[model samples]
Target: MTRAPAHDLNAEQAVIGAALLAPNVVAELAGTLAPADFYRPVHGRLWEALCAMQATGQPVDPIALAARLADSGDLGKVGGAPYLHTLIQSVPTAANASHYARIVADHARRRQVADLGVYIAERAGTDTDVAEIVATGRAILDQAAAGSQWSPLIPLGNRRHLPDFPGYVLPEWVANMVYGVAEFTQTPVDLAGCIALAALSTAAGGRAEVEVRGSWREPTNLFTVVVLPPGSRKSAVFAAMIGPLLTAERALVERTKPAIVEAELAARVAGKAAEKAANAAANADQSGRDTLLAEATAAAMNADAVTIPVLPQLVADDVTSEEAASLLAEQGGRLAVLSPEGGIFATIAGRYSGTPNLEVFLKGHAGDMLRVNRRSRSPEHVEHPALTLGLAVQPDVLRDIADMPGFRGKGLLARILFSLPENTVGRRKIGADPVSEQVASAYTANLGALVMTLAEWTDPAVLPLTPEANERVLDIERAVEPRLAPGGAWGHLVDWGSKYTGAVVRLAGLIHLAEHLRDGWGKPIQAETVERAGLLGDYFAAHALAAFDDMGTDKSTRYARLVLAWIERTAATTFTKRELYRGVRSQIPTAADLDPVLSLLEIHGYLRQLNAPARTGAGRPASPSFLVHPEVHGSAGTVHGLPGWASRRPA
Candidate 1:
């Protein structure tokens, strides 16, 4: 006997009723609940009508819904106008209509799982590769994880919650600038923080380093990836905030060009002198030869003294590891990579290198000594290199990088701080006055001072933590270390959590310099700055957990998810191999492809295999039958029933 699919008729009625009662409900529920989520055919059709009306920006009242349904020949099946009245009467209020929709969505998922199981059973003995079946299973599970149409790991701006900058603990100047700036661009205030951090890191450069504990000093470099949808002002925000740095670098390069030309000309003159000296030495008497060699050495020394400035490049949008290494050497190991379109991720992941260049990036972030040797070029090395990466990519691009090979396992992405704020594109009031001159002046002045401070660095001494700051650093270590320990709360994010302590110290150094340092850069960070940086660590920890959760969803369990959904929906205990195909063929396209799903099902204890005697006289083999576990419901359970593992729950 087949059990009727799980559904909440009242919830379906309430969702429809709420929408009919309040047309505005359509907007809120549109992202999470689909028309097929409704349990009843009439409810599903009615919800579809409401959505169709909403799509055209029309009112979703009774009149509009009825017209849509009647036009689609669905009005009669759903009890016409009277049924609409009954649906409207089902809801007490429209405030929780979104909640009601959630109920509908949950039941719909259960129903889908049941349907997927039928497909799994039918395809179990077929020709489909196990990998394909597993992929489909993984797809279903991914759908379930993102059932709310929002993934914390794979951020979609349409469904994220934007951070409140006014609520953030920022410098008074930054706080003041954020309101006018975010409003003008309709960007999240968090973007302000990201850009500010980058500028601060660029300012601090290789001049300042943070020593959190013994032998664990990290440069004040930051890597922030802000996820947003296309046209949500990512490029605009990036340009507005980072534009000043670009200007400063360009101006520096221009100023140095004259010296560079002079140095090259002087070097050429000295080269000719050295060549003439060498020729004279070839033919001169013994005493004359000695004099000529001495003159040549003098000329070579003079040529060396006429040094040209390297191009002043503090930030690059896209560059290979080789190029970046050279920049770090030229800029005293302080460099930034900023791209609003997220080309940097692709660049690092082999659009140019044919292999991920994460090793160089990781070394740069850690401010470790980096040595890069190219095939035909002299080996370049930098001591204490700092690479600050600021990237803004659409949700799809983030997904692409997340799917890139070796990201999660290599923890390449885990090193980055991610911000996915709700989009404010359509809601902002644009055309505000240019950023307040007072705020702009302060920001630029601070950045200029930071640049000059780096310019004044004759000695590269590590910045030591104050005694109070050292204690706070220890506290941060103690706080995050336990979480990475065995049976810890954040064991899932140990890869990221492992480095957060150092990140906090680096953040403290940046904040201290950005706020307090004026003409000089070697001052120790204050205790208050350490405390504030710890607060930021907490904030980033929350975001990291969200990102890791999405990334942690295993890739192999996909097919099993579909099979499990199908199994849960059926009331029947046993299904023969051929009989299962008949039931699930409609849901799963190819009967031959379910081999992995069914084999997985039996292997996991969701189903048990048995052989039945074949019918007489045909010398036939025994027929296969699978019995689903009686207790196989949606609660605590196992997919594989492996030893030393608890029943895995759906995320």
Candidate 2:
């Protein structure tokens, strides 16, 4: 038989080429793969650079990359620009990325198996703890499947190269504003801070009142989540950046507080007066009573129509679904939930366990009408409620609530822009230089302007995209949909991608409004605006995928992982089904768990069944057995841990 050394150079080249052609797909592709997984030395280097660029929010374009590679003195390593060109033109389209990815991954597994055999052979004779050796082996398997593994995200600094936020540079005006934030806070400018500010500004413009669509319409409201560990300065950054918007909201309430109170008191007084007059009228003569009662009834109607303009409260931290709806209704169908507390998730999860009230929150995200009818209470109805939600929970807290029902399947969690940055704590200096007053003042003043503009926007127009901008919307769809197709590399995250295109348009509207809220739109939907939104979508999807992975890892895959660990720990290959069953019964527990996991191993080519009659007495039947692959299981003729396998296992 013709044989090769467990590597497919063609598959490696195909994967590298796919990425070179469509760099935007890097995040999803990178999740399950790494540089070391590549068989070719040059291909490994190329992948490393691709990942580096992607991780740093940098473009992976050829011209830019050629210059970078030349600077790093490694352009000659991969045969320079021509090789990159070859890789780009290797495949006809990126649609085959999943196919190429699978082929490359399969070769990577073969390579791993080859190396693992040598590793196990050497260690088999060592005096090391068998459990420790097995643990090490399981860890190697986990690395092979990083895309589906679940583990703690601690020592945040190590996450520096995890994945990148949107690499799209902000518009000069917006960039200038964010620059001021970084300058004053003396903190690394988290793009999320700016994203949060923009989302809130747009929310205030009114999600309920507007739907910006291309060929289709979607709610203007957005759900934003800036995920990071506690003490990552999310709260401080958000508080500062969002401070002006909140201030304007508070100022509106304060300015209108007196008038609202006066109107309410007047209504109460009018109600009492009407009641007294009715009582007196009841005791009077017929004509007198009728006239008095008429006057009192007219007064009551006037009082009823005199609905006091409620205080201009637009942001809420702690509130129930009913109250949030009431606020949305009262505040022109716009409100934001900005909180550092994790309770926000629980509230969204539901006040009581087992029974979740997610429909209201889901509707709020969709800008759908919410009508609450209670048997014992006044019904509350909102035709369109725009709820802009922002939460910064620690990573651990995120994992805890990830399993909440309806979070993934119902698309509640999928509709969010999730941002998780590497920790920057140790690098920050005590008593760093303070931000100059001018920049800080400008930052706050700019937000104040946005908030004021929002306040003045009594009936926020449902802005339509300009013709060219509408084209860009199509472009965004074209760009995002291919990746969402079934059997695509990103198929696992298609649900998240489903809402992503529209969300980008809504965000484009927000960015447009923020920059040119003062001046009339030159063209409401600029190409740059849509492009920026696309970049943000890409960036946020990276984080969202990472977060969602913890929640949606398949159960059988998880059990398969556990089974692999046990097999590795035992450090042996051939054994009767019952013997292996006894060893793992505690964790695997029942036949249901064991059977599927064993099958999974077989499907993955790690194990296979052996058909044989037992050497035991005639009455003793042939119990089932498995032939674990050598290197993974043990040498074919020599089963290390099980003695019966030496005689019974087929040579």
Kindly report which residue stretches of model 2 are placed more than 4 angstroms away from their true locations once superposed: 1-163, 166-174, 177-188, 191-195, 202-215, 351-354, 373-377, 429-431, 456-458, 519-523, 553-651
The window of 10 residues in a row where model 2 has the poorest summed lDDT is 149-158
Q: Model 1 — TM-score against the truth?
A: 0.59
Residue 134 displacement (Å), model 2: 32
- What ranges in model 1 sit over 4 Å off? 1-168, 285-291, 294-298, 301-306, 374-377, 430-434, 519-522, 552-651
lDDT (0 to 1) per candidate? 0.69, 0.65
Candidate 1 lDDT at 617 equals 75
Q: Write the per-residue lDDT of candidate 1 for residues 320-340, one digit (tens) a residue.
A: 766787777777778888878
Count steric clashes of candidate 1: 11
Candidate 1 at 584: error in angstroms? 29
Whole-model alpha-carbon lDDT for candidate 1: 0.69
**lDDT per residue (tens digit) for residues 163-183 in model 2:** 554433554445665655554
For each candidate, give its TM-score against the true structure: 0.59, 0.59
In order, how many clashes per candidate? 11, 1
Best by lDDT: 1
Q: Give every collision pair in model 2.
A: 573-633
